[model samples]
Target: MTRSLPALMLGAALVGLSAPAALAQSAPMEMHAMTAAPALNLSAYGEVKVAPDMATITFGVMTEAPTAQAAMADNARRMQEVFAALGRAGIADRDIQTSGLNLSPQYDYVQNEPPKLRGYQASNRVTVNIMDLTKVGTTADAVVSAGVNQIDGIAFGLKDPKAAEDQARVLAVRALQDKARLYAQALGVELGAVRTLNEGGGYQPPQPMPMYAARMQMAESDSTPVAAGQLAVRIDITGTYDLGR
Candidate 1:
């Protein structure tokens, strides 16, 4: 037996589907059609305090001698020690990056004389990422003890920051809702569904507070106190809502 929908039933189904769409399409694109026109926008700044799961140390070797070759040899010898220590600490070669290298003449200045060129200086910088935080302090100490004189800086941050970013997004949404509610209450209008949303800014990862003087010397025995302060992840959202009548 062949069965077909009646004209009336088919007409009703079509009408039901089209009605809401039609309303949505022709619902008077009103950017401004309300009493006591009020625009309320809110922004919130939230921070998450997390111990740095990872750390980075930028330090290099600087050597000076009467000859360029001698300077380079000194630099290479000390740098090899640094690499050896890093390997002992279980830092993979892939995580180590040779950031910079330079060889220049050492110049001396006199009160009333032309600058005299003393010798050649060879410098090389290496950047290493320590995946393990438990050994960050000791690792830093080890590197310095191995003749890494110039500790450019030590920074701490998260390896995976997606979780923190998600939390920040939720905070942004909640901030928007609070704004909407406050605006609706003040304008004596009902709260409405969001029609548009704009996120002006994304979350910024936590920055490491630089932890030491100009350079960390090898002689210092106390472990550097690295405090990973709270990282403020801010998300700015601009949202437009459909007003209720």
Candidate 2:
């Protein structure tokens, strides 16, 4: 005997398969309705001024000689002296880092001719982190006295900025929430849950201070003038809030 499905049973099976796709289409519509819900966008910025507690200075010794080996040797000797001076200034070995070391041949360009080899130049740059702001001037003096002929520049920063930045972020979010609530009240609508929160800004890294050619030299009585101005730690945030009926 041949057996076939009844018309009503076959129709029910087809409907069951298509029910999932119908739900899929309605799912997007539901999400679209949620996205289109009335909402308020708020942005707030917060900044806190804090005096720098630490300073970083980059300075080095540059030497020139007829041979690369000679130049390198002279540079090494001067750097060793500078390292000793830095150690005496209460800088830890971990805080002193060799930022750069290079040996390049000096070239002299002639009119319409190939460059001539003048001499070999070697440079060793060291970066020192001073935890005490009061030692900024004295440290610079010490390094210069120990034969740091080239100075890149100095930058002032905080040793730990996480706490300050966290406070700023909290303030920014609070300000944003306050604003959102005030707007909602004025518009005669209840404030609903937050739809989205975005961090628009945060603390900026330290920047190199201005370079002074005259400050690099000392006559054994002069100390480098280092002024660590207050750095601003800023935070900005944006929040989207849904409107309740």
**lDDT by residue (tens digit), candidate 1, 58-142:** 8888989999999999999999999999998888999899999999998999999999999999999998888987777777777
Candidate 2, residue 164: how far the Cα is off, in Å: 1.1
Q: List the residue pairs that clash in candidate 2.
A: none
Could you report the Cα RMSD, in angstroms, for every candidate shown?
Answer: 11.6, 4.3
Deviating ranges (above 4 Å) for candidate 1:
1-46, 203-208, 213-225
- How many residue pairs collide in each prediction? 0, 0
Cα lDDT, model 1, residue 61: 85
Candidate 2 lDDT over residue span 77-168, tens digit each: 98999999999999999999999999999999999999999999999999888899899888888888899888888899888888889888
lDDT of each: 0.75, 0.87
TM-score of 2: 0.82
Q: If scored against the real structure, what TM-score would every candidate get?
A: 0.73, 0.82
